[model samples]
Target: MTRPETLQASSKPNYSSPDILRQFYQRLFPFRPLFQWLNHGPTPQPDFQNREFAFVLPGGAYIRYQSFLSADLFKKQCVQMTPERFEIGPQYSINPRDRKQLRKASSFRPVMKELVFDIDMTDYDSIRTCCSKAAICNKCWHFIIMAIKVVDTALREDFGFQHILWVYSGRRGAHAWISDKRAREMDDAKRKALAGYLVLAMSGEQGKKISIKRPLHPHVDRSLKVLNPYFQDEVLAEQDPWQSAEQAERLIRLLPDKDLTAALQKKWDSMPGRSSNQKWADIDAVAEAGHLSTLSAKQLVDVKQDIRLEYTYPRLDAEVSKKLNHLLKSPFVIHPGTGRVCVPIDTRHLDSFDPLGVPTVTALLQEIDEWESKSGNMSDEEKAKVQDWQKTSLKPYVEYFRGYVAGLLKEESKGKRSREEVAIEGLNGMEF
Candidate 1:
């Protein structure tokens, strides 16, 4: 097993040195298989370690990954860059028992594929503009994640895809990358549209409903050709220059905005002129170069099935269950799984505090204010009684709110568990 500190040291990217790469690879071997677990999608192995796959460092140096774990540990380890062997501390050394325990914890999870859509963290200007302090606008983030889940769930239910993986991008948003064999062939356009729709959908409005009649944005179709494999087939079938022009004309006519039409024309002008054969290439060139046609075919059917069946009950059931699990784990609620107690403010209390009750809290407050305004007519005795009523009446509501907040604190305490403790508990009967 690799020591955590040694693994951490390897993250300081020194690509010029073969010695460094070799050291990093050696440190990563024991945990290399963990990538399979990290990934929730069909773990497609690249034929060669490609430049497209490299880690983005804080200073903009992308070190190509010879191995994933060492590379991940390297980024995390290097963040604290120190001259000593163990910058994080002496406690960072590897433990055989800990590695065994990590393996045991991971084994309980089902095998699934992993996929990533890592937007460059260095692209902070654009990311901040869109994400806006990580506070989502409209329904974009919700829709994207929901779309990913819907696709994953539909594939599992309708297409017998048993495994799906989802994770946060570790920055602005989340990634619902899928690995199911069925999703490999989806054309870039369809996938892109689904993702766009998920991201740009209306929040808290009727438009949020996913329906069969959901129309694809025209721009989504054009960009789809750029990303998905399935759309390549449609592009490939339209080999004639005149036919392609007609499709483009039709797509332009469908655009709702004149400004968008101008933008499309500008983009079209810059695109390289394709040879008759090249124009028809259905898949991304890099993916094609890697002989990934079979994977694309499998992904397309699954993707279509996912979009079409988004409204089905089994899919809804899965989604609700996932939400319920999250809700249960929240500190606001009494988490049944962890036996955590919740704040006891039964919202039912708010139901009865109406304007009509005499000697009632709200009513009494109104009466006291009115009497004070007309104090010229009243004796001192009336003012004294009103003061006494105000103090006595409001105390219970204030106390209830304080105790309600206290109960929430208790629930949070019960749910809190260290990572190591969580790792051990997830192992069930497995021995480390």
Candidate 2:
């Protein structure tokens, strides 16, 4: 397929400073319908210039939309977050190994021309009462952003998806674009089921009795490609053509009922080998034995939530203390490892600051190195005293780095704390 035009050469207006976020919001208000998928609430009032939105994820890491997808034809065609004024969505897709490259090429994809689906809380009008905490509370924005990744993984692993596009709603939540041709023909039931699959919720009905594990209970790794008959061909040009709609319909008819569970199982059976299919059957047996039926396609896939606070700027950083102060004034510490900005209950309003500031790690580290160098040549006892002072003085900096790293690992399966958080915790406990 031909690649889209280069966004860098285009003359689309871009904003690099936070001061312009207000102006951008004004520009975005008129396009509210354009971002209806955000599900934050009634289209934000035009007066939302100074308001902030947190581009967050389920992993607890915020989406960093530094010049996010401006080139996406979808956004451009959608007429909401056009390249002319706003850069809608995260600056880059989640290809972590190329993190540096994405950071360097900071810009939004052209608003995608293709269709997109957004998940948000149905009750956006009552955001304050609804999303009070991190876990129990519901933040549609976070749910939408994070849920898409889970869906993307599912599509690529269970189905055969090579590319997907995403965009921010410029308010709360986001819009994701799937480039796969198969996506267009999906029925409402399948779409809804797909949505539920990605949300990854525990089976509330069964409570402790039900077990909901991710990456699917059977693990689609390696065996997944069998579902795509196109891959079986040894020669590149000899691959089986994608199933026509008529053909797909006929094949689908041969399956059982189209309920979420049945559809999912049908998809598994669509693959080549019955041996791998048995694994899915075994998985179902385990679920049934454990009484985990509540873990249906709806709870895990269908996501309907609202995004509350919209944020702009790079990822969470140490100096963000000053910036987020306007939103919450909590006595907060940013953990570099997780990039989670934690506020002590005593200083909960740390976000009240007008214009937030987030310092880069390089800048923070340089300051620490300078301070250490200046204190060199001192006696061990004197050095110990200085070390104590350093800890007290740089506590915020340490927390910032720790949380930042932690945020990076939000997508990983391991439940372990980030190495930086552990180190900081150890350092925090150390005596002078």
Candidate 3:
């Protein structure tokens, strides 16, 4: 019989060096805190015990149905295997390892997982002018910043969900994991409904006009308010998306009145290289000068408001959030492409969160070596006092993550019923 451990994927990214990966799994990874977060307590429970974990092995092999009884065992396997990365999936009704032994295949199915959102930079490529494709810069990062702020505000205030954690995807985007008991309990249908409510309906080509209807929903109104400040500076000033004539035409197409657009287009055509802010100002300037005859003041206000939303609103990839069993990359894993550790974004100090500044596995490992060299003569007693992870730049991120997980567990304890209790109540309603 072929050993399951020997199974390998035909293709996978092998970015992290084997020795470094082994050390990471051994010393750096916070297995206990992660286990506590998933398990919702210090001791083992169905949340962690029956949860599905899929690993991408270093030899380009993929493995699934991986579960552990405790954090230590999970860490032991990771260190032994030294897989490139692993993904977290929904908790099953039965232990994933034991699913095949069941009499009925249908008896084993996914039950619950954190509701997740994936916001990638590629989604904003059409609107952002600073960087496109796979490249990301601090300037272009404002798009992600805008997306996070808008989505986070809506999730908390509008939907009444707390315990939301925003994590950098380690390359050009971000992911949001909502661990609220209410959020975790949502079925695929409810999840889809919530995602639909969050996602803006801006379909078709880039230049196509977004059909923003009258009398916006309270959520839309509130989101527009959240996005208002960013649109002018981050979008209009920094991006200057409508500076070119071709792009300017795309802008003109979105405007309401023919007289207003004609006047603006002529003005833009005559004076080349006009900045987006100046062009925006020119709209009010021309309208005040009586260029717009047919469009009402009330209608114009509505149009401008819609334009703000069209430009700056969060463009969510709704598919990610509309499922119960979908697997998402675990929060703390190293991104294969960038080699950066996925770190939690502290919403309090959001403006200071820089993706490029995130510590890479290599860099973190080096920091450990440098610290060990400095403390070579320290007594064994003193050396054993502090965890090895605290010695590197990854310290702050891990500390922040552990703290976030603590808050979630505390809230989990306060809830009326445990995760399993609540899940068991509505078993028939949920799709596995």
Q: Pick the candidate with the highest TM-score.
A: 3
Identify the runs in model 1 with alpha carbons over 4 angstroms from their true place.
1-33, 37-52, 63-133, 136-149, 182-432
Candidate 3 lDDT, 1-432, residue by residue in tens? 111111134443344778878988888988988899889887899999999999998777989999999999999999999888898999999999999899999999888899999999888888778777877888778888888998898899888988898989988889999998889889999999999988887634556667766788888888888888899888898889899988787778788798999999889889998999999999999988888878887888888887888778888889999989898888888887777888889989998788888888888888988998999889989989979899998888889889998998888776735766777878967888
lDDT of 1 by residue, 1-67 (tens): 1111111334433332333223322321112222222221123232111101223332445443222
* Candidate closer to the true structure by TM-score (higher is better), 1 or 3: 3
Deviating ranges (above 4 Å) for candidate 3: 1-14, 416-432
Deviation of model 2 at 127, angstroms: 16
Order of quality (lDDT): 3, 2, 1
The lDDT values for all models are: 0.30, 0.31, 0.85
Q: Looking at model 2, which ten-residue stretch has the lowest summed lDDT? A: 304-313
CA shift of 309, model 2, Å: 26
lDDT of 2 at 172: 30
True-structure lDDT of candidate 3? 0.85
Candidate 2 — which residues are off by over 4 angstroms? 1-148, 196-209, 213-216, 219-432
In model 3, the Cα lDDT at residue 169 comes to: 90
Tell me model 2's lDDT, rounded to 2 decimals: 0.31
lDDT for each residue of candidate 2 in 305-389, tens digit (9 for 90 to 100):
1000101001111121111111221112222222222221111222121111223222334455676677777777886654321
lDDT score for residue 357 of model 3: 84
